[model samples]
Target: MDLDQSTTVESTQSGSSSSGYCRTNSEISGFSEHLTDDFNSCSSETSSPVSWPVTGRSPFRPTLSRFGAIRHDHKLEKDDKLNDQKPTDLELEMMKERFSKLLLGEDMSGSGKGVSTAVTVSNAITNLYVSVFGQHQRLEPLYSDKKRMWKREMTCLLSVCNYIVEFVPASQNLQNKPSMEMMISRLRSDIDINLPALIKLDALLIEILDSFQETEFWYDEQGSMSRNSLSGSFRGAPQPQRKEDKWWLPLPCVPAGGLSETTKKHLRQKRDSANQIHKAAMAINSSILSDMTIPHSYISSLPKSGRTSVGDTIYRSMISTSRFSAEYLLDCLDISSEHEALELADRIEASMYTWRQKACSNYPKSSWEIVKEKMEGDKNVVLAERAEILLFSLKQRFPELAQTTLDTSKIQYNKDVGQAILESYSRVLEGLAYNIVGWIEDVLFVEKSMTNQQES
Candidate 1:
C-alpha cells in the first residue's frame, strides 16, 4: 500500500480541510496570489507558466506553491510534444516501473537508497496537516479536549508506524523501532496546549523519521539446490539471505590490551577539548562568585547590635566566598566522592575562620590598615588592580588538576569524556523541554476545569 497517497485521500475525505475548523481558501489563495504576482513580474508571458532557469540567475525561481504544489514549468519542443502526444506501450510500462521504483526507494536519485522512505513518510504527515489546518492557525484548541486530542494523535502515529512496517524493509524497520518508540513516548508525555510544545513535538517526530531514513540494511545472497531435467540436483538462483536475530550491529570492539595508537591520539585531542571547556566553566563560576555581594535584605535582617563589628562582617563575606569556591571547584572537577569534597570545603572554611580571627585581633591596624592606606593614597586603584590580577591567575590555573585527571581517564579508558558531558547536557535540555510541556498542560487543565465548575 502507498501510505502517503492513502493518507492524502483520507485527510481530504474526512472534511478536515473542508470544514470550518480549517482555514478558508481565501487565506491560502491570498498567499499563492502574492507569489504568482511576484513570478509574473519576471516573465513577459504572464498567461503561460514561467519556467525558472535552474542553472542561471532568474527572478522566477522554482518554488512550491502555497497549496504544496511544485510550480516549475518545462518548455516543450515540437519533437517533445509529438513524443508526449502518444506514448508507446513499452514507454508506458517503463514509466510505471520507474514510478514503482521511486516509491519503493529503489531509485533514490541523488539521495542514498532507503533514506528517501523516511523523508517521504515525514513529508506525507506534514503535508496532511498543512492541507487540513493551513499555516499560522492556532493549535492550542486541539489539546483542549484531551480525549479527542489523544485519539487523533494516536491514529496519526499508528498509521505512520503501520505504513512503515508495510513498506519499509524489515531489517531497517526493526533497527529504527527503539528510537521511534522513544520519540513517541516523549511526545505523549510532553505535548501540551501551547505553540512551543507543539513545535517541539513536531521536531521530535521529524527526528524520528530521519533516524528511520538513515538506517541501511543489506541482505546476503544464498544458493538453493534444485532438480533440472538434463542434470542432477543443481544450484538454483541465489536468494537473499536474512540477517541474524540481532536488533543492531555490534559496536566496534577495542583490542584486548588497549586501543590503537591512533585512537589514543584522538582521545588525547578530545580530552584537551574537554579541558578547555572545563576551564571556561570554572572561569565563569569564579567571576560570578567574585562579583557576589551581600544582599541589602540580608544585611537588614542582621542584628543591629552586632552589625557594626568588622570581624563579623568580614567573616560572613569570607564564608560565602569559600563555600561558593568549594562548590565551583567540585563541579568543575566532576568529583563523585562527596566525602572528599566536603572535607575540602571544611578545610577552606577553617582557613578562612583562622584568617578572620587574626585580622580581627589587630583591629584597625591589621589588613584594614592596608586597605585604608590604599584607599587614601590611590582611591583603591591599587587594591582593584591587585584583585583583578589575582582573579586572572586563579581562573587560568583553577582547572589544571581536573584536566590532568580527565586526561588520565581518557588515556586509560579510550573514551571521550567530553563528548559524554556534551551528551548529558543535550539529555538535560530534552528533559527540561518535556517538564515544561507537562507543567503547562497541568496548569491549563486545572484552571480550565476549575473555571467550568465555577460557571456551572
Candidate 2:
C-alpha cells in the first residue's frame, strides 16, 4: 500500500458506480481503497507504544514523498483545530485596526526615529501579535460566509507574516543583528518583491488624496467663519458676515527701494549679515541645551511598535535626519502629547549615546566639535544642522567613518542666511503636515473593503 500504489476511481456520466484503478509504479490520481490501510499503518507505526526497528518496512510502507504529504495533512489538521477557536467581534476589529495601522505605516508605539534597539524591536513584535490575534477574532464573519473570502484573508495574512519576518530581526536584537541600515535595505527589496500590495495600498491612498485636493473648502473664502474663532464683531457674539467683503491683510512688503540692481545687491548684503547673526544665535541655543532626560511613561504611550509601514517610514526618516539628533525629529513627529514629546526626546538622546559608543568609537574629534560649534550658531544652524544630519546618516551607513563628523565650521553664520534656511525648513514641515492631514482624511473617510461587492 505504498504511495506509488495510488488508485484512481472514475465514474461514468450516468453516475454509475466509481471504479477504482491502482497505479503500480507511477504518479496517479484517483481514490485508492488502500488509502485507509496506508494511513493506519503509518499512523500506528509513528504513534506506536513501543519503538523498535522492524524487520522490514510494511507493504503499506511509507515513502519520503508520502511522508511529506502526511506532514501537510497534519498541518491542515492543526489549522482546522485552531480555526475552530473563533475570536469575538471586538477582537477582530482590534486586529483590523492594528493591521490597518501597520499598513498605513503609523508607529504603533513611538520610539522616535532611528534609535532602534532590541527592546524596541521586541515591543513591536508583541504589539503585532496582539493586533493580529484581535483581527483574527473579528474576521470570523469572513470565514463563516459560504463565498470564499478566506483566500483574500489568507493572502493578507501571508503578506503580514512576510512583513513580520522582515521586521523582527531589526525590531529584536535576537542575534547581535546589524544596524537598521541593512535591515531597511533588505526590507525595501522585500517590499518591492514580496509585499507589493502594501506599496499599492500606499499609492492608492495617495491617489485618493490627489483626487480630493481640488475640493474647495468653505474655510478658504474671505470672512469664512470656519477659519476664525467664534468671537463676533468687537469680540462679543457671532455676527452675520458676507464672505467676500472681509478685509484681508496684504502680503508682507519687501525691503524698500524698487527691483533695481542696487536693491538686489543691498538685499543680498543684508541677507549675508542676517545669516551671520542667525549662526551666532543657533550656537548660543545649541550650547544652552545639553542633557535630555526622557520619562518612561511618555515612551510607553507611543503607538506600540509593529511591522507597520509607518514604523519603517519613521525609522528611515529618522536615520536620514541623523544630523538633527533623534530628539529633534521626535519633536517634529508631534506625537499626541507634550509629555510624550519630552520622553521621546530623552529616549532618542540615550539611544544616540549608546549607538555612538557602540557604533562610533572615536569620541567627538576636534574637527567635529568645532564644526558642531559653528553649526550651533544661530545663523549657521541650518547648514550646521544639515551637515550634522548628513554626517550622522553617512556614519550610520558606513560605520567605519563614524569617527569623522563633517566640518562645517568654515561656513560662517549670518541672520539672512539663517532666515532663508528656517523658511525652507518651515515649508518642508508645512508640506508634511498637509500630506499627513490628507492621509488621515482618506483613511477615516474612504472605505477599505467594499460594503457589498458580490451584488453587482
TM-score of each: 0.20, 0.18
Off by over 4 Å in 2: 1-261, 291-310, 313-456
**Worst 10-residue stretch by lDDT in candidate 1?**
23-32
Superposing every Cα of model 1 onto the true structure, what RMSD results? 28.9
Per-residue lDDT tens digits for candidate 1, residues 23-92, read 1100101111111222222222323321222344322222221111112121212323442355467545
Q: List the residue pairs that clash in candidate 1.
A: none
Count steric clashes of candidate 1: 0
- For model 1 the TM-score comes to 0.20
Global lDDT of model 1: 0.28
The per-model lDDT (C-alpha) reads 0.28, 0.27
The candidate scoring highest on lDDT is: 1
